[model samples]
Target: MTANTLVNSKLVCVALNDKAQLAALEGTFNEAPYKKPPTQPVLYYKPRNTWSVDGAEVEWAKDFDGNDVAEMVVGASLGVVIGKETCRVSAADALDYVGGYTVVADYSLPEQSYYRPDIKGKCLDTSAPVGPEIVAADKVATPDSLSVAIKVNGEQKSAFDLANMERSIAELISTISRIMTLQPGEIIAVGFAGDRVAVAKGDKVEASIEGVGTLTNTLGGA
Candidate 1:
């Protein structure tokens, strides 16, 4: 596993009670129009079987019906690790609860407009490539103002100003805490920017933020 994928990215240990099914969690962020602090934090989970580390590759699978699988989505998100137990936190005190930050590339096969209900499309092995390193939160002055971008096959494809995020970093932390207790070392990935594209085998994916360095991985067949 690469250091960039997990360090500071909140890793939540889950249990699947039934033998036939696995537990999963989906990563989320606020989209525009709903900008300014989110009224509430958003969350979703994938079956536990779908996680993978850096350097691993995911194979494209055909659905039950015979149709060429057209697209997939890879989400590169900024993860925030909570430093202390926080519940019902105030926005002003949110930054103090952060332990650090990391980068995670969340992958989904065969692009679908909605993220949930399409869990099978997203939870494939080796789809999530994460790690490089975790930069301490103290090192970043304004987490909400950082610049994030992505490149595929050395071509720039997606870019977003962190300032444009629907919700500020601190606000998200505070808002989410109210729903569930955020523990030390727990992770929270900032949502993706508007740009989403398709990728294929042999392509290289790179995600970067201004203060946080880049994490790169290549797509390949199983």
Candidate 2:
């Protein structure tokens, strides 16, 4: 809701089932680790610098190949906002800690591996654009399954449903809490199971999740 409210909170991203992408990388790199999909939630952090509100501009400039203004992989996802301190919670009771849900665009530079933290790729300024509003958890008809879509420059580029996620919202919360404590106001980006394509400067990107909300951001040169 406010930057002050989220000062100490963390933004965690989860990968539900990225087998196809992983396998593709394995072939390109001829590596063993990418041969199979991860069994658990593959988590990464989007630090405070990445935080932005809906309608904000997401700037990108670092090009890994050193050509052109860098494009980003835009991930449309559901964001679950934590309402209370959570630790070792059970899947059955995980919803109790949720404050609400919002739409988040998880942006990052194109990456080949998830083996190590890609701080430069993901933790960039305005990489995580969240919210125009927070729909109280109880308002969402079915948190587990919702239609999600992404558009760049007014052209629809990707579409999918949250129902395709490998884990339920509660299960994800239960699983993540066992590893680290989640504080109030923190957000868990429940993962994007759809296509994530690169977008360039001046592209107006919009990511929306059914029943939750929609977030719009303009990609600009850094």
Candidate 3:
């Protein structure tokens, strides 16, 4: 299904390990050094425009530099699909709200700042590719300790264990629910632990999660 058909409100993509990401961000916040990391979940909503199904083609539109500039970064992350309307949920009951899990490849252009949301940089067409299949949350043996990785053209560029998340999936869901009500079919892309790599046209990107399976997509030049 298309993103609009699957989601009604927003798709929250958590930015875990706030300190590492902040160190990479391009600018200052409030004209001061942006040193303090968010104590709570750092969430960014990727609208339907950014969603694409697994195996779909994601367009890497040429930039002001023309065809030579077709490139975007891919963030391979575990995703939680909400099973019901969730609001003010508790960490203890957070997983109960999850319907299933899916692999998500969050695509975006290189940006230097988090002080402001970069709509165009992140919400481009086919930016968030999710699927392969949704594994029921209960069936995911250990969602908190799965292995995650990203590959480009069949070569692994980055690999990491979810064991390192600053906040577990349950805690993230609980914190996020307090910020906004999540509806059925909407998703929360659990944060990535390491660096995201840039991919260009003609490249095939794959996001693999140990239990959830891999989501693959090809990059096409616009």
Residue 34, model 2: lDDT of 51
Per-residue lDDT of model 2, residues 1-222, tens digit only: 335323246888885344444454545435565556566788888888888888877777566685654457888778899989999999999999998888878888776567778887888777888886788988986887787789888888888666677677899999999999999888988868545778888789888787777788898773
- Order the numbered candidates by TM-score, best leading: 3, 2, 1
- Writing each residue's lDDT as its tens digit, candidate 3 over 1-222 gives 364334446678886443455454434432554566555666787887777788898878556556545457888888889999899999999999999998888888875566577786777778888888778888887798887899999999877677777778899889888988889888888878547788877899888988799999998873
Task: List model 1 lDDT by residue over 106-180, tens digit each.
Answer: 667744334244556766656665556678889988787677678888998877676666567787777778878
Which should have the higher TM-score, number 1 or number 2?
Answer: 2
Q: Which residue runs of candidate 2 sit more than 4 Å off their true CA positions?
A: 1-8, 16-31, 34-36, 63-69
RMSD of each: 8.8, 3.1, 3.0
Q: Output the TM-score of candidate 3.
A: 0.87
Q: Each candidate: what lDDT?
A: 0.62, 0.78, 0.78
